[model samples]
Target chain A: MKSYFVLIFVAVFMPVAMLAYSIVPKRLRGYVLLVFSYAFLMIMSGRPVVYLVAATLITYVTGLTMGHFQARRDAQLAEVKKGKKAIKEACKRTNRWVMVAGILLNLGMLFALNYLGFFAQVGSGLLSLFGIDKTFEPPLWIAPMGISFYTLMAVSYLVDVYRETVKPDRNLGRLALYLSFFPHIMEGPIARYSEIAQGTWEGNPINRQNLYTGFMRIAVGFAKKLIVADRLNLFVDPVFDDFSLVNGGIIALAAVLYTIQLYCDFSGCMDVAIGLGCIFNVSYPENFRQPFFSLTTSEFWQRWHITLGSWFKDYVYYPVSLSKRVKRLTTMARKRFGNKYGPLLVSSIALFCVWFLNGLWHGAGSQYLFFGMYYFVLIWLGGLIDPLARSLATKYGIDRDSKPYRLMRRVRTLLFVFVGELFFRANDLPSGLAMFKRIFTHFSLETILNGKIFNIGMDPADFIIAGIFIALVFARDYAYEHDHNLLAMISGKNAVIRWAAWIAIVMAVVIFGAYGHGYIPVDPMYAQF
Target chain B: MRDQIIEILEDINPDADYETCTTLIDDRYLDSLSMVSLVAELEDTFDITIPAVEVTANNFNSVDAITKLVERLVEEDED
Candidate 1:
């Protein structure tokens, strides 16, 4: 079947669904969401809906099982006249086993579906090196769309239930709706159970203001995707497809363009998701927060794909760092290396694990792995030099928070992020390295200024249009960075001006958007993950 | 016991008035790292095992809540 994801479909589906959603009774609105979501999934994913249902079932049952054991243990403890420790220990052991089984089952399915092929290829190649020739073919696996997202969400669900931070929802449908919620299924803010579950079930009646805001938000998202990201893809595809032929300037320009493309594409998708949720009065957590304004690599991560980083931090980083083994290692390292560097030893090891998983979670590619390591090294180096930098600033009486210093730090962080995206966008690890080599070795100012950029599928006019849109995006982001809302500003204007502005945005997208003719639709970037 | 819990909170983050800050976790006065350290410290100082479930904000939102949680766990251990 031909893919049903066209611009026209999105334009129609959103309004129609919103209308239907508003017509439903308030209490039944949650089920309307479920029906809409599953319908969307069936249309988009088809057979792979099995994976979503299975993940929901396994996690749902696991949660109930864990909760049941916890209750039994509490009751048993109350009944016992003595030896509560023994009872508690036994319960802990059983719950730990159940948690392990739950995590392993879901993760195993994900690994088998996604990474099994990559591992098989590597394994067979290794075998050939030892004078044994055997061709091993991995089984064909059709992984469900959004497996990365829902799997991570499921793990968080189990962890939250296990930690008793939130009780397991006894209603399987609510849990199902949470996992399969259509707007966020493809690309997620990776919401926590405690954060969004109650609101999902509360099903607040649709409001007129929310409709106006949601439609405006969706229009802005379409403008970003259609006007900026897709148009830039024309140039980015050609340059990245054959990096060896391009000189330093073109590659550098392409790197910068790719970064813009990635941000607009991913964040634009988030806008649609969040805007769709707004219609139902379900405000999902934000995924992006003006990431380009970050002053450090750490701050960059905090602002970029915020949910994923927070998920990794809360679920992976904290657990690993606080575990008894890491605690013991911290003590030993402190004794051996002194207090200053000792704690870093534990942090570095845990950070390594976090990055390793972070890289793998992106996809089954070695380049993705390197992308993770690149940040890990940068963050670690930043940590190592932090005290020295602070001391020097203090000694020199320099205000590090001053405008110039902050600007300088932001520029440095921007370059770091651009370089990381260069690796991430490359075809493979070696090609990324070669591109880096060309960037430094084959530098030429004439190539960029003399109009070589216009030769790559896009004319000068295309660049100008894309450039204008990019500037608009930057201005809006800058305002947003200062916590100013442009939409709200528009709303405060007179009726004629406000209506004119909204009409102008919609018209500009239709007239200048990259879609209508000869435009190849570029899939949303993070949707692949 | 409340004083002891406040001392631990102050040791971790001295800026916030832990005794009266009922929305410590909600307002992000205490982040994940500080919370982890706080949990470890509470367990060590009170000689009570704080299960992962008790890490919720309901039990650690203020010194009073934390004191109550610790006392309950301690009493359970004695039983």
Candidate 2:
């Protein structure tokens, strides 16, 4: 059910919907997208559509209520000029209650569906530790697909309305479409209400150029998913499944491969989603910007999962950092320490909460939590070292911007990222520790030469093909990093060149892509989160 | 007011030329960290609260905008 074939079917169905949309009234086009989006959700998620609808209804009501309170407060302020403060206070209190209610309800639904079982197990484990053993068999709840994604979208939408950044969409259906757009329902760019509301409402007709670019983008996504990521997965899954059996070299190789597989899989899905949106003239935000090229763990995060990073920064980081208590803490620290250390202390506290929640957001696992802390420490250390490193560079007459220094930093960042991903992909915290120990203690060149690397699922030919595809991926990303407009460049070429390029992609996917009768489609990695 | 704002900006990051640079946020002259510090300085100096919603590039891109925001917050407090 998670196959690219189904995605291809949806791809075909969307264009057909647009063809039908062309004949309808211009105003009706938006509803076409809405109808199609819901139909897609129902078809894909089945009973979980209930969760989707419930989330939609909750946000829709919250938005409308907030808007109502805002309007009434403005009128009251205008009429009762003497008690403006009282009126504003009342309105603010009422609006805050509505917003809190909305956030809690949506987050509550997510918790019950996603985290309740994990918590129940934790509770039972705690009981056992206290010699009061209790077996709590958590309810078997069928959580909806994209609950994580849509709930965040819902929260962002409500917050945006509360802030008056954008007016609440009066039309429920358009709002519904914004929440449950099919392309984004898998793994979102977590699009903002302001970013996509008007465009989603308008649903512009499919232009010829958009169609060409969109389909091409989808082709590139398919090649990455099938030709690169899925193949790498063939190698990564087995090694990680039984890390104890593999040699250290193989395990280390597995970490790099897992990183590659994850990047391609997640960003590849983004490509498909963004490309699909383009066909309907709906543009989602970019999620990745050559993250592997980042010179620091912090920069890597900014480039990777660009939407989620910014979402946390805006909703969690900024608010917490600017809160009265944290601001007070900043002043206290500044009085005690100097300017640099005070702000750093404040930012460190905020970063702790962000990373803690970020870890919990990924999953309830200890390893996932460790993964969050791992990067937190790295980024915090990098911040602490910034001034010292600059001074050292100046004293040594070393150019920080020069190629050698930049290259060294990139390598250092990759090393940090690889170790973090190793933990992230491990089965458990203990397993992660064991494999990491093996990597340092038992690693040797003979591990690869012992003919054991090929024993994992992928053969030599698969490795060669995956290697070539990965190289091409890096090359394409490198071009993009240099600001090369690859899609536009291809489009501007002659017909033979364009057709050949498209055909080559299709042929590569068909020939080498990991699919057919025997393969079970590995669900897109970030979708489960 | 502008001179005071520039002084605060320079006190935070002496490298930034807040005198002429308009795209402080856009061009990375004042990143999120500095922006937070700037907001805190302005609030403390002007005796006004700058809400999180008003902390956008439009309100902090230049000394003029920062002065206007402080003035508006002051007017609101008086109101």
Candidate 3:
């Protein structure tokens, strides 16, 4: 019941849902999905389901209102050739206000639920800083599960409609279903309306190929979550929870392991979500693309949690960077600083907004803020030095595209990611800083070499098992990086080979999955976000 | 107009072969900053506003696409 990874979910809930979906007529299958989606949300978050309903209603009304204005504009334009521009502008103005109000109302609900306490504390701290003796108790509110994910989808839906990229759906059920689809409602690939709305609403019969592919993918997810991510939690959690007990070497190892744990846990969940989507004939966008292979922090963002990044890019980056005022500033700066740095200056301003929110979007914690700013600074610095780096490479007769150079860049990017994730995983900002300080100030080879590492929750056997699975994952990612599709290759094989592959994965999870005695099952980490 | 757009693109990023290359944004030949500059140059050169919605890959992915977008925007402006 906690997540799709649970045995009851896999064995009972999914099978029942799939059975119900299949039994229903095709015309009614979409309704089946909607009913199940709402049931899932209600089971997960209870009364907070009202938040989702409110958001859906607001988004639906906003989209329809925008559509109405757009229709009016077109009609007015046809009638008046002389002042058509004025009419168009007037309609655009009205739609823009409607869109803004819609966005703010949804965001305002999200802010009240997820961020009110955090911001209240921040405001109180500012008051005390100014010698005013005022403190407010932070309110405790139960946010709807997947509120963050669904709210973003709702905003994107409204924005897309306002932009005239997609027509407003008159079917309230379809819009609600898109926002509340069970598989991605917990932790999303954050699908856009334009991308998967129709296919999801179609409720196509679960085809044979899709069933096989979806099951195979879900099995891979189980193997990853059970084998690698959960096993590492034994070591990662202890070190992070009580970092002062360990030396710097252990702290550093914890950082790397936590980063791996996060990737496996989150991306494993994505595999399950996307796989479930496949079974239902809905194609969710990918959330990760071998992010460790990225050569820069910017590229890293593009590869990791790709939907969130693109959301910010389309909704935040483009709008802010290309706004009339910013454009005027860019023009003036380009005239002064030239093409290379002028737009960079303005883009950095927008990037700051993207990262700042990106961080807060993860949580209201200051560490999340630091995590966002860490990438913002690194990406900005990367852009700032890019021309210089290129010129230097040219001067030294070095090919940036050469294998060695690219490898080096990837390694550097990975290191930067590890540090960023270290802050991300820390208990809080100060603890994160303290652990980071330990890495350099108190690091000791003796701790790792003296077998002290084994005493911290994970034994030698645990390490070996986790390492083997991690290597398997790396090989899978490696093949994917080179454009080789492992699933496709397996699928293309004869039935015997495919079944064997599938059985092997299921068995791997059964044997190696970290569960039962002496182990605590970690919740899907991103679900907390 | 096509030549002018190509000239603007080349000025932004000379490495691309604007004549036939069509995946400028997809391939990231014109990265975000370059796109910003390209939009500014196109607007300045053609006296057409390049709205953020119009800055999609389909509009800026190729010289022909950019020319088409610019021409349409120009006509809209005149209208």
Candidate 4:
């Protein structure tokens, strides 16, 4: 598998790497980059070259239609510039067709790649009742690599262009590169065209400073991934894979470990990506934001997956809220339903759309969808009671921003996030729900102490190491939030202290990092995006 | 129309823009999210729907510009 990945990586990355180093025109560089990104992606999907062709075609057509729409509008606007308002009404209609077409094209790939199997299952199940099954399975089930990540990027790109947040790329090649940039092709921090357009198109040179930073980050990431996260998984997988064999205490610990494993694995991938981008002289947005330190799930969102969370908030939630239909509904609700439930009913629809898409982005499964809605319901409920919470705090003469309230909120958010991850980590939907129910049913602490799954590997010392790691996480989060400048401050101290901090982080990974033989190499979870 | 638009702009960004339109939407003085919120509030305050097309810089450039756009939209709806 490692060799296969190496072969695929060389096949996909070597050309792009060369292009990055090539003295060719910067703008045309995006063309080579786009071709290789998709080609590499298709080749990685093995024999499913058709899926790649289909996604590329869909995205290509969508961008062309969008650009065409923009051009037509520019022409009409110029004609109107000569002071002719007579045919402007017709121009508006034409522009609307373009917007509709853009949306259709962007959404077309989403349905084709992600939802086809889901709809088939539902349709076949419905048909079976009448013995009218029509079989539909495309033989090339090698699932389009990076379909989920790039699809969102494409949708947001078109949406951004339509909204004029950014200009419509007239060149289809630049647009394709924006969608399929290889380092970001698989799991992404989901770069927006607006964010990277100037940097990606203009150019940044590869300096030793950037090179060292990139490699250092990759090393740190690999350490977190191999030594810290994967090693801990030896204890976690059994507890989660078959919870029937474990007790509540064990399950609870597994949930927390899974959280750590996910963070290490995911943020580690971001480190690698950001590092890779560093080598290319582009800076991608940081996805994880010391999430555990968040005072509310809302705040947690602001910290964790900041790009994706904001993407939904900006494109979906805010737009739906301001839409004419929603405003009208809100007005009607306000007059009839009063302030009591007016905003709730109106925002719930918008919130549900964001959450539903959020869930579906994780996987092509109901469980992931449930995981997203899980936070949606929790956050919405929290939002609903905000006024009441403030008033109650006032009556009690307590500060809402005080440490205690913040601590309580943080605890609440952690619990909320943890429960959502429980569902997300489960093998399947039913198993996830059943495992959840087992939390209430089979309550015992003995399983954790008895080492039910330690037979797989992991010692008492490993648990302690995990605990120490978790503590370090919290400490680092607090420092980050408070802007402790601990490292900078300490580096100012005796050289002994500064170098010690560096050595500690490095040596810990070197000695304890999980790698080599009988160990499952866990890929970055976010990479599946 | 100028005064009404000024009132809305004041609510969103009070420190600047008492004169010519400031390209409020295009300049992104109010970010996309906050701009949407502002739009919803303005529609409620002034009784109009900012059409998707009307959301461009040609109309939303400044207080006076937005006020004129809103008046035009409202008049068209009334018709």
Q: Please give the clash total of every predicted structure, in order.
A: 1, 0, 0, 5
Q: What residue runs in model 3 are displaced by over 4 Å at the alpha carbon? A: A46-48, B14-20
Residue-by-residue lDDT tens digits, candidate 1, A1-529: 1122365446676567767767878778778788878878777766648888888999999999989999999999889887888887888788878888898889998999899988888889899999889888889987778899999999999988887778988988889889888778888979888777777767787786776677677778878888899999999998999988878988998999999999988888888778777777778898888899988897788788989988888778767766777766766765786544565656777688888899999988888999999999998787667657867888999988699999999999999998999999999999999998899999776767887767886888889999999999999999998889998998777868877887898898889888767677887788787
- Where is model 1 more than 4 Å wrong at Cα? A1-5, A46-48, A491-499, B1-79
What residue pairs are clashing in model 3? none
Instruction: Tell me candidate 3's TM-score on chain B.
Output: 0.97
Selected candidate, larger TM-score, 2 vs 3 = 3
Which residue pairs collide in model 1, if any? A163-B53
Give each prediction's root-mean-square deviation over alpha carbons: 3.6, 2.4, 1.5, 5.8
Task: Give the alpha-carbon lDDT of every model.
Answer: 0.81, 0.84, 0.90, 0.68
Give model 4's TM-score for chain A to 2 decimal places.
Answer: 0.86
Q: In model 3, what lDDT does residue A489 have?
A: 96
Ranking 3 against 4 by lDDT, winner: 3
In model 3, the Cα lDDT at residue A479 comes to 99
TM-score result, candidate 3: 0.97
Computed on C-alpha atoms, the DockQ of candidate 1 is 0.20
Ordered from best to worst TM-score, the candidate numbers read: 3, 2, 1, 4
When only chain A is evaluated, what TM-score does every model earn?
0.95, 0.96, 0.99, 0.86
Q: Is candidate 1 or 4 superior in TM-score?
A: 1
User: Which parts of model 4 have CA positions greater than 4 angstroms off?
Assistant: A1-44, A47-61, A79-92, A127-140, A338-341, A450-453, A484-508, B1-39, B48-79
Model 4 chain B poorest ten-residue lDDT run: B26-35
Interface RMSD of 2: 1.8
Q: Is candidate 1 or candidate 4 better by DockQ?
A: 1
Model 2: per-residue lDDT, tens digit, A1-529? 4533355554676667777677778798888877777777666666548888899999999999999999999988878758889998898889989999999999999999988888898899999998997988879997778889999999999988888888987899889989988789878989998888777778577787888888888889888888888888888998899988877888899999999999999998898888888888888999999999998788888789988988887888788888889888877877777666667777788788888888878887888899989977887777668757877888999988799999999999999999999999999889999999999888876757876677787878889999899999999999998989798899998878877898899899899988776454777888778
lDDT of 4 by residue, A1-529 (tens): 2211133353556535755555666656655556666666666555444544555566556556666756776687776555344455555456557666756765676677667787787678788889996866743443466777776777777677666667766656566666676667767878888776555555456675566566556555666676667877887787777788777777777787788788877777777677777766778888877888776676677677877887887678867876778878877875776544565667788888988999887777878888888888876776667546766877999877688888888898888778878889988789888888888788787755677545645777666776676576567667877878554465466656655755776677666666566667665666565
lDDT of 1 by residue, B7-35 (tens): 87886666587757898875556654455
